[model samples]
Target: MKINPKNGVDQLVFGMKQNHVENLYGTPDKQFKDEDGNVIYLYNKEKLRLTFYEDEALRLGYIITSNSEATLLDQKVIGKNIVEIKTELPFKSWEQEDFDSTENHFNESNWLILQSEFDVIIRVEIGAIINDNDEFDWKFKA
Candidate 1:
């Protein structure tokens, strides 16, 4: 599927309603609220985690995956380094730590973050985060 950062994963969009998500992905494998009150729709079979804000809109905030089979458009994402990844999906502006620095997953410093209208983060030796702030307070929220 084509991964459009501005729109969303395939047919999904940043401001799309929860029903739209259900229509696109079907029923979630699991659904729960995070500590901060965001609703998480976990599709274990699909290996996708979709998090929505806790407001009237309930807009999508985060799209996360650790699945190696997942791809952004035709680009294979999992386990690839920044250089190889860039060749597939080149980003102009990014935030990252020193290559030799120890990982800090909580802070997400180990990943290379490309924050535009949407936030696309590629983790070191792991997965990726395709996020959208939308009406959220910060550009990049936890």
Candidate 2:
């Protein structure tokens, strides 16, 4: 699903496969396949560390800071709900545009548009899970 930053609406939808990571974000710098056949890819860019994983069938992705104390910072910053995090640090219009451009090229279940102060906007999506859980689970479906 693609989101409209100007409005809180879902714009488009597409299908994706289990090995579609590169198609979505190009090749990753480091790739690790666990003993259980789960794959994890790491992409390092400036202050950001993008981690993509197919853990047991669930497609889990996250981004974190790459500062010297990144591990400590991650422990403090990771796993917060979007609403809680966004309330403290509102997204800007330019960021929304960047997000829209990046995410629209990929496949998602459903997308959402969120507005903030200064007319800023953000697009969010419920991504797929590639793990070994129940196949019919709709947890990520928006």
Compare the candidates by lDDT and give the number of the best one: 1
User: In TM-score terms, which candidate is top?
Assistant: 1
Which RMSD values do the candidates have, in order?
8.0, 13.6
Candidate 2 local distance difference test against the native: 0.33
lDDT of 1 by residue, 11-126 (tens): 55565567878987898989999998888898787666777878635777566665565555477655555454555554544444444433222223222332211123343221
Model 2 ranges off by over 4 Å: 1-19, 46-142
The TM-score that candidate 1 achieves is 0.62
Collision count for each candidate, in order: 0, 8
What lDDT score is found at residue 128 in candidate 1? 31
Candidate 1, residue 107: lDDT: 21
Q: In model 1, which regions exceed 4 Å deviation?
A: 97-142
On the 0 to 100 scale, the lDDT of residue 34 in model 2 is 60
